[model samples]
Target chain A: MTTSREIRLKSRPVGVPTADNFELASVELPPPGDGEIQVKNLYMSVDPYMRGRMTDRKSYVPPFELGKALQGGAVGEVTASNDPDFKVGDIVSSMFGWREAYNANPRALAAAGPMGGIMKLSTHGMPPQAFLGVAGMPGMTAYAGLLRVAALKEGDIVFVSAAAGAVGSVVCQIAKIKGHTVIGSAGGPEKVAFLKEIGVDHVIDYKATPDVTAELAKVAPKGIDVYFENVGGVHLEAALNAARPFGRFALCGMISQYNETGRPTGPANIIQAVGKSLRLEGFIVSNHYDLFPAFVRDMADWINSGKLTWKETVVEGVDRAPEAFIKLFSGENLGKMLVKL
Target chain B: MTTSREIRLKSRPVGVPTADNFELASVELPPPGDGEIQVKNLYMSVDPYMRGRMTDRKSYVPPFELGKALQGGAVGEVTASNDPDFKVGDIVSSMFGWREAYNANPRALAAAGPMGGIMKLSTHGMPPQAFLGVAGMPGMTAYAGLLRVAALKEGDIVFVSAAAGAVGSVVCQIAKIKGHTVIGSAGGPEKVAFLKEIGVDHVIDYKATPDVTAELAKVAPKGIDVYFENVGGVHLEAALNAARPFGRFALCGMISQYNETGRPTGPANIIQAVGKSLRLEGFIVSNHYDLFPAFVRDMADWINSGKLTWKETVVEGVDRAPEAFIKLFSGENLGKMLVKL
Candidate 1:
């Protein structure tokens, strides 16, 4: 028998999540039987989108149930395998995260679905944890939203909110590699420096700036053609104000509104959309997994050429996973926030 | 020489415009010069979009110049012609509205551009005044916005605001003719009855309805697939509230917020766009005139089949044109509002 430690939802959160909402529990597992594989998780990811799952409301994905182990992206090595497709010591990624180890049927893991599905990673000279960060769902999100959803064109100026986050960092690099001028907005001097390090043409430290709209106007005098929205509210209003005619905004995530208890006020200048002929479209990365092959190929090339890079704020051990998640809402993480199991 | 009475912008409006913002003047016109046509306008249009032009700000179209005649859609009879393309008694439409008569080079009238450009009408048993309303810019707006901008599909239910107005009434009929259930919102008993007369599946008298969002939900229990947005503020918030996944909104205008002195509050639930994966696209009718051929042909067939109808509120003389325009904000017009000279 093998014993594993896991975190389960003790109670749903009212506003911002607290460590008390999660409880550490341990379970004993018998030897893998039938088509099951045993995995020992090495690393797991915490993202802003998971906040929606905690709420008991109908959305694109189902809400997380109380008294159940929470799920997310995780990389692990197969400790044992009864399935012929995977052998012992093979590294794999799965949605069975927030836990230290588990035994699962291969078919069930595969059925975790897009962005949450299981996959075997070759690593290709990179760390297995890279699958939970840059080379994974967050990476694919940046690629699809900018290239496909926003329909980025030559000479189009790109603006990204939350520019120091996992998805936004990749978006910044992709726009640079494609030879377009990029503008990014983030909080604090550290994130501002990181944005500049990634070759962002213009950077706005929203923490220091009193009015983001005026700051954006001063930087993008000619106006932006594409807006990659990660933070909503004021950022959205600023984008609307600075957008040129026929501008396109890819609504990926709105982390700013994720923790709000009440309905938040939206952009007051949204009416500018009509006068300027803007298009704002919301999308989930899972919906565009059809571009996986192209995304993987392009990311591999960029990584090999040293054109793509990422940063992470890691917390050690499974017991601290909830704290890492809470840090995300506070802007305490510089880039991707991960828990090392 | 012939005398013409014209209305000019006397002052820019601070908020909601009053009669003092406009002025009436007389101008003398000589016989038609070379390549020129002299026209006596029979009917002039008073539309909601003109509100934008009255403000001194950059928009899709240039703002109306102060101390000059305000321009809009008008149908007139040619009194004299120096060009072979037109003859006396031939009916023509031009953008030189707010004036009873004018002599202009045919090329200048043709260069009025897109929705404001000049066109000689065949009439084809329809009244010449139809060129300024049902058969002109407003009809084209409803056509392109619904079919192309919103990309209406079969079995998709539609919700339209300002369903008793010029462009919106056409949108209602088109949805009905295409065999889709349509829910429309208008003010007053007369406007509500007009919506039913045009075969709208559900009609909400917004003046009597205290909660538009709740009323919309009661009528469209399955949620709306396509939203034709004309009235903004409350209607926009309600549409965002009841939108199903992948719903599309074609934003044509926002008459509700146009006269506001300060920044008005936007939809508090705009963040719902991200969760529902909705698309909101704003458009100007002039941008889609390439669909004019299809729109004109389809409109003719619909009219001949007796499946299409319209209403107009007319005020005699150019002196009352400003009053007619102001009545639009109060929801006093059932459908198209016009001024006769």
Candidate 2:
């Protein structure tokens, strides 16, 4: 038997979660059964969607049960394999996150599923941790959202909220590469600088601007054609006002109001969609995972050519995973927030 | 010179429009110019969407400017003609309404463009008044919103708000015709009775039900698969609660919110879309006019076979057009409301 340290959901969170909501424990793992493998985690992803699982609501993904080990995206090395398919040294990614070690059935591993948000880590001349950040879900989200949902047109002006964050960063970069003018909004000077360095035509430091909608209108005078929605609330309202007639919104997440106690008031200007014929659609990365092959291949080529760049805010240890997740709400971390085990 | 009485926007209304907001005027009309024909108005439409045009705001259709004739869908006869293509006694429809008579260029009558929304009236064994309701924009809205936008599957459990209204009534009947069970909600006992007569599986008298969401939950225990949103605000909140995962919302209009002084707090539970992976798309019938030929054929067949039936609330004379349009917000008009000139 092997002992592994793991974090589990202690209780359902009411609004904002605290350390008391998660319980750390030791679990004794039995030998890997037939067609099963044991993995020693190298890096784990702490994402916004994980916050939804902490609550007892019926969402696209199941809520984390009390006293049970929590799961998400994790990249690890195979330590022990009963099946010949999964060798001891093969690098793999699974939905069995929040743990230092895990035993999983090889059958549950695929490119897209509840257990396999993505299965094998396509190294693609990148670091193993890259599978949890830029080269993985966040990266694919931006690719599919822009190309498929927003329907990026040539010479189109695009606006992205949370431009310094994981998904937003990639979205802004891809829009620029596709010959579309890009406008990005971030919370601070460093993030704004990062956006500028990445070739964004215009950047808005939302922290410095009192009226984001007015500022967006000023910069995107011709009006935004595409808006990648990461943060909701004020961002949606701003997008609504800035977007021209027939603009498309690729809505992936709404991190801003995930922890609200009462019902979150949506954009006051949602009615604008009716007037402008704006198409606002919410999507999960799982729905577009079929594009993974093309995404990974294109992303690898882009990285090698120095056309794509990324950042990771790593929190060292499985014990600090909860803290890393909380930091996502406070906007403390830059780029993709990850936990290095 | 010919004289015509017309209704025009006096000033933008603060909240609910009153008689004071509209001006009754008589205009002197010149003879029909080259390529133009004179039309004697017979049946004019007073639709809920016309309320949106009353506001001095940019929309899919231009606002009804102050001190001008308010234009909408009107079917009339060519009393006088200068164009060779148009002959005397030819029945036609144009974007001329809220008046007794007018002279318009024949180019404005087409199947599809800015001028295309106003088509040459096609009465297929149905009354000319039928062209204003069941065989016109309202009917096409119901057909396209279901078959295209909402993507209604064979067994979809449809929930339509304002189900006794023009578009909603057609939406409910179409859902039933496609082998789906339906629940419809409308104000007062008369509208509810009308819905039941039209083969709705269940009907809710919304006026009597204080908690619409709770009432919806009771009727649609299995949950709704498609929501045709004609009324926004409380109805939208109820639909959000009743909708199942992956449900689609065809947001054609929001009549409940057309007359608000301040911002109307939209569906408080709109974030439910994110969780349910629900898709909400607002649309105008003009965008899908290609479906008109198919729509008219199928609708005429349905009406002839008695598989479909319709009702219209007629407020006679062009003088009462404003009062007829106001009836939409008050929910006084049951089926397609019209003004007989």
Candidates 1 onward: DockQ, in order: 0.82, 0.54
Give stretches of model 2 more than 4 Å off: A30-35, A108-114, B28-35, B107-122
Question: For each candidate, C-alpha RMSD in Å?
Answer: 1.4, 2.4
What is the number of residue pairs that collide in model 1? Answer: 0
| Candidate 2, lDDT over the whole model | 0.85
Query: What's the TM-score of each model vs. the native?
Result: 0.98, 0.95
| Maximum-DockQ candidate | 1
For model 1, what is the alpha-carbon lDDT of residue A199?
A: 98
lDDT per residue (tens digit) for residues A130-162 in model 1: 888789999999999999989999999999999
User: How well is each residue in B170-280 modelled by candidate 2, as lDDT tens digits?
Assistant: 999999998899999999998988999999999988899899899999999999989998888888889888888788888888877888778777666666776676777
lDDT, residue A28, candidate 2: 94
Name the 10 consecutive residues with the lowest summed lDDT in model 2 chain A. Answer: A109-118
Per-residue CA lDDT of candidate 2, range A1-341, in tens? Answer: 88888899999878888999998999999988887898999999999888998888777777889999899889999999987778888999888889999887777564244546336665867899888777888999899988988888887899999888999999998888888899999998888888999999999888899988999999999899899988888888899888887788888888888898998886766667766777777677888888988998888888899999998899999999999988898787789999999
In CAPRI terms, where does candidate 2 land?
A: medium
